[model samples]
Target: MKKFIGISILALLVGFFSANAQDTAKNVTTKVKESAVKVGDKTAELASKGKNAITDKVYKDKEGPNGETIYIDKHSKYYWIDKKGHKVPISKNKLISKQ
Candidate 1:
């Protein structure tokens, strides 16, 4: 009886780990395609790891108040990302023109 119960638990754990294996293999491109939002002439995906925002696009020349180059997500939301990849909110004075 103990042998049977031990095998059942092991099988259950194996099944659970197998199922989760697929989830952990999710790639960046897959995530981008999942969250792709179109904005004007550009498209951006809001990929985040915790509080950190991820961007597939190269950092542009647009500068914010603190002189950090700005980034625009697919939602057209502008932010200044920091060294730690945290999306820092910009001030209203740094509002980006839609034009």
Candidate 2:
């Protein structure tokens, strides 16, 4: 009778530990999924902002000092224009207006 009782107790302990491990694994999976969703949302927001920025920077080129032409984008960083209308990088401080 004593041996039977000991075996039953051991079986119960094993079942309890197995159930607890399963619950822990499920919790970990849920957390990982939540984190993935948040990261995806942030990426989408950044992409939307980038698209809007490009659309807002489209502008016409005009002549500047010493025959060097400047292409001005009211919403963008400073860019210079070549004879072929290609844009060249300029200093941000010179291009951007101080608020």
Candidate 3:
């Protein structure tokens, strides 16, 4: 029983060392995509030498049906884009201004 416990601890240490030595570069990448409006600047700058998503344009923050926050450009008509870039439409009747 003692031998089994020692062997288990040794195995755990070896596994931890091997995992630590594994290349982390491949595992690190930005999972976010940038649309016309960019929100992933900081991650991109860290990823590359030096870069960022900067814009002089302005956007408005809006809410989806389920209460997800979304950003909208000035030209965006009754629709807002979700994080996945999918459109979540808002009806005129359901809008606070319209109501």
Models 1 onward score TM values of 0.32, 0.55, 0.28
Estimate, for each residue in 1-99, the C-alpha lDDT of model 1 and write its tens digit: 999999999999999998788776667557766555333113222233222334434235456665655666676666765544466766546754432
- Candidate 3 per-residue C-alpha lDDT over 1-99 given as tens digits, one digit per residue, 9 for 90 to 100: 999999999999999888876645334432233332365544443333211112112123434455543333355545544444454666644543211
For each candidate in the order shown, give its overall lDDT on alpha carbons: 0.57, 0.60, 0.46
Q: Per model, state how many residue pairs clash.
A: 0, 0, 0
Report the C-alpha lDDT of model 2 over 1-99, residue by residue, as the tens digit.
Answer: 999999999999999999999999999999999999778776765564455346445323333344343444665565654433345667644443322
Order of quality (lDDT): 2, 1, 3
TM-score of 2: 0.55
Query: In candidate 2, which residue pairs clash?
Result: none
Output the number of the lDDT-best candidate.
2
Quality of model 3 by C-alpha lDDT: 0.46
* Model 1: residues with Cα > 4 Å off, grouped in runs: 1-61, 95-99
Candidate scoring better on TM-score of 1 and 3: 1
TM-score of 3: 0.28
Point out the worst 10-residue segment of candidate 3 by lDDT.
49-58
RMSD of 1: 12.6
